[model samples]
Target chain A: MHVLVLGSGQLARMMSLAGAPLNITMSAYDVTTDRVVHPLTQAVIDQTLDQAIAAADVITAEFEHIPHDILAICDKSGKFLPSTDAIKAGGDRRLEKALLDNSGVKNATYYVINNRADFDAAIQHVGIPMVLKSALGGYDGKGQWRLKDSTQVDTIWQEMQECLNGSAQQAIVAEQFVAFDREVSLVGARSASGEVAVYPLAENIHVNGVLSLSTAIDAPELQEQAKQMFTAVANSLDYVGVLAIEFFDVNGELLVNEIAPRVHNSGHWTQQGAEVCQFENHVRAVCGLPLGSTKLVRETAMINILGEDTLPTELLAMEGCHIHWYGKGKRPGRKMGHINVTADYSGELQRKLCEIAGYLDAKAFPAVHEVAQKIRS
Target chain B: MHVLVLGSGQLARMMSLAGAPLNITMSAYDVTTDRVVHPLTQAVIDQTLDQAIAAADVITAEFEHIPHDILAICDKSGKFLPSTDAIKAGGDRRLEKALLDNSGVKNATYYVINNRADFDAAIQHVGIPMVLKSALGGYDGKGQWRLKDSTQVDTIWQEMQECLNGSAQQAIVAEQFVAFDREVSLVGARSASGEVAVYPLAENIHVNGVLSLSTAIDAPELQEQAKQMFTAVANSLDYVGVLAIEFFDVNGELLVNEIAPRVHNSGHWTQQGAEVCQFENHVRAVCGLPLGSTKLVRETAMINILGEDTLPTELLAMEGCHIHWYGKGKRPGRKMGHINVTADYSGELQRKLCEIAGYLDAKAFPAVHEVAQKIRS
Candidate 1:
């Protein structure tokens, strides 16, 4: 089967790699250029967009930010998986919050602000020390503002207003600050035939709002709750393909943070840790094939190699380390690649994390060092 | 670095997949078309052959049967790994036998027959009930003859004489048939810097001379012997890249059968069973990167899917099964793809193998059924 992916990025590249061994061909459209690129190598294909679209048997997205017009074209084809509505909900915080509330899933209490009156109401309802984020076009802490006290609220509000001055949609979401014990994410897939499979909860650490590291956690209670949340959201949306839901673990209680309607960075560990990776599972789900096993086979820790033009060659020599360079030119704060290390025990996994951290700049990767130190102590 | 491969087949395809995550670009030459194909996707490139060759930082071969003229071009570049000499030795049974004898490795007693006089000597030395094999252009039981009794010797000799009548090199080897307990292969790699790492020995079973299944064996003594054999051969050859040596286990004693200079079918289980796969290790050896760990993470069994146009979709749902389709046309005796199943225990692995065998034709896949039945019993 030929699968057309909406974005040509690392996730799409990896999905193509996983699909190749299953006789599943992938054609990716560059969202920025609207041109076709080979999914596995990211080389510009010598074909037009129409030709690529015509060849695809199914359509999916690597990310939710695909333009609405392109999504409309795929929707007309009746081959798109997970529905455009699901992508919209994943991209827009307001729609996602509504879905969470409707599903009775616990999330940080929040309010939407489209004007001064709404902002005032949000402040009154969500209280101080809240996070003000644009309902759309926000990721990795971009398009976001943090309110520490009343003194800075007006300044942040003016900044948001200025940013939204000429936008068609002038709205933001204010969420109550959640003081959580740890951050975690659950990645799962739902087939077009209504079959669902969820991987284990992965404890995550984000630095400067970009994912730094993620390790699979074996908390049965939290894992069960996470599975329930995934099922409720996926079944309600009638989702097809992989879905990743991030959560904040607050003293054992889980709260929804956000959801990604595609294969996610947090689930990259599954490539080396689980019987079936998230990319393969996503392909199987969209292609109307049965989902593979999601069983975790090892204790895995994934470390993002952000913005580094070169990694130490010694890292490859480290036991259990697997490097995944994206073959993209390095840019500051961009995810250039990642390394996954698997171990038989949590202690060994921590030691490996520390070893990897040594090869990286500690100041630039404070989250990695923090986790390493936490585990060391 | 960009890597140019000599052959564009599934082995090259998998090598490219393994190299991509290491920031390595693989460009493969289709020996038939003499054109460049993207290794992972098999899409023909629009660039010129010289341009592709100029862009490559190193040259390698996916298989040992590369034409000598192309080997000369790559040799002139001085960037080819596992030098042309090693590949030549691997392709020619005579040279390989000489190397085995020089290394003091125990192989089945054999004699070369180049003419009628030599054939008479071979018959006298090797006796009846021997195997006659062409010194060149042979694989998977082709170009071979088995002598069960003296009555068939002259007939087979006349057939070989007819086929080799016009050939420049008219030669074959006759060997005393070995009665073996099982077939096994040891896959290992030697870096340019002389670093070597060996994976666990894989117990292999072949049907009609095509490998059908291989399981990682934990026999310490036999594994040690295999490692020693690999090390002696690799060190003597000054090899850099993965090497596979097939052996016969006769009454607990190991006897060398053949050697492959590149990754072998017997090592496909490493994809999901080891910390690093044979493909990645080969890439590392040729790229001057440090070798990753060869630690086996799970007990694995690999099954080849040969010549079939369709596979049951339900097989994907089987726990621990990983499919690898080559995207090749279905032809009798062609390797279309393979499936790998990994489990935590030997009993569980066998059960999974039986489960896979159920999806295949019992008659065509008697080897699979036999093993499944043996495991069940």
Candidate 2:
């Protein structure tokens, strides 16, 4: 089977690797290029866009932000997975909130706004300490406004008016903030056959609302609840392929926070922890194959290597730490790669996390040479 | 780094995959094609043999049976891993035994022979109930003859003579048979800098001496012993890539059975169980990157899917079971694929194993339908 991926990136590259042995050929288009290459090759396959699309048996995306024109072509082919509707729901906060309400998936209260009057009314309804998100193309805390005080209301209203252009209308959401203990995400896949396989709930740690680390465990109650929520959402959208649902754990309440309608960064540990990786499962689901397992092999912690941090050779020298470099040119706050450290012992897992974090942060471990130097002093 | 591979097979394919992300390119030359393609691609990258070698930074084989001409080219490059010297020891039983004896690694006593008379004398010297093996190009119970009684020796001698052809003498090993409890293998990777990482010892089961299943677990004592032996052999050969040592558990003694200079089939579980797979480690070692963690994630059992059996969908439907199908046209006794199953609970692991094995073997479980049929009967 031939699969065409809408975006060409690491996820598409990984999907190509996973699909190769199954005799499922993957060709991905970099919307920027007319030349289509096998994801792993980064070499030219088809010189024309139409030929590449004609060659594909199925069409899917590595992420939700696929260009509307490309998605329209796929929709016309009647072979696109997770559907354009599902993707739009995931991409726009307003659509996502509406879908959640209609699907009966519990979520934080939200109000959509188009102009200053609507924004003012939303502020009145939701009050201060609310999250105002652009309805489109917002991620990792980008294009977001947080109202922390009433003094900022006038500035926010002006900003909203400017954002709306001359029509005094622009789509956005003002959501009531839920004070949560922790953030978790359920990365799950559903096939066209309505078969759903949910990976273990990943406890995510975010630095400035960007995912930094995700750890997986057998938290039975949490897993079961997350599984139910994921399944219900997948079924409601008639979703085919992988979906990641981020949840705000307010005490025991799992308030729906967001959704990623593609294989997510949070599920990266499944590459080593499970028999089948989330990327592979997404390919299988999108290609209409039976879903593979979503079981965790060990407690695994995945740390994002943001920017050009000097690698800690000492960390690689340690047991149970696996490093993956993306080979991308690095910039500040850019995702260069990640390291997955897995172990049976939670204490060891914690130590590994601290060690990697220290290395990436360039914070020297004080327990060894420093201790000796201090003793001599 | 540029890596030249001797054999163009799946192991080579995987090595290429591991190398790609690191910007370490691999070129594999199939004896038939002679055209070097990017290993991940079986597409031609270099049409001339000399050009391929000239482009290589390191040369290696995916298997031991590399044709002599290719070995000579790699040998002249002075960059061949597990060196051509070490590979020679692994490819032939006589050389393997000689190396084992010189290195003081434990092994069954053996003597080389060229003819039936030599074999008979060696058997008389070593005693009956012995094993005979051809010196080269044998794997998984091939090119082997087992002698249980003297009465059948003459007929076996005739078959051996035909197998040997007329060099007037072909090499073979005559040794006492090991009465073993179970078989196991240790896979270790060493870098040019003398840094080495050993994956946990894997318990293996072979059906008719062809590996059927393998389970890798963290047994500290066994791991230390295996590490000691592997490190000794690796250091002795100045090996700079993956080395797999197969062992026989003779009553409590770990007698070395054979050695593979390339990634061995037994280490397939490492794909799911280890922090870094043996293939990735081989790539890292050859590419001059720091070696990855060899820690086992959990107790994992990998089952080879042999022959032309159609895999059942139910097996894939199970949690924690991942199937990897080789894109090969199937035949009886051909390796179609393998399944790696892991679990948090031993009971669940065993149950999954049985459920998957039953599906593959076409044995139905005792379900409500079966119970109802039994009641009717």
Interface RMSD of each: 0.9, 2.7
TM-scores of all predicted structures: 0.98, 0.87
- Pick by DockQ: which candidate is best? 1
- How do the residues B285-316 of candidate 1 rate in per-residue lDDT, one tens digit apiece? 99999988998999998888888867787688
DockQ computed for model 2 against the true two-chain complex using alpha carbons? 0.42
Name the lDDT value of residue A83 in candidate 2: 90
Task: State what share of the real interface contacts each candidate retains.
Answer: 0.97, 0.61
Provide candidate 1's TM-score on chain A: 0.98
Clashing pairs in 2: none
Model 1 TM-score is 0.98
Candidate 1, A202-282: lDDT as tens digits: 999898888998999899999999999999999999999999999999999999999999999999999999889999999
Angstrom error of the Cα, residue B281, model 1: value is 0.4
How far out, in Å, is residue A132 in model 2? 3.1
Q: lDDT (CA) for every model shown?
A: 0.88, 0.78
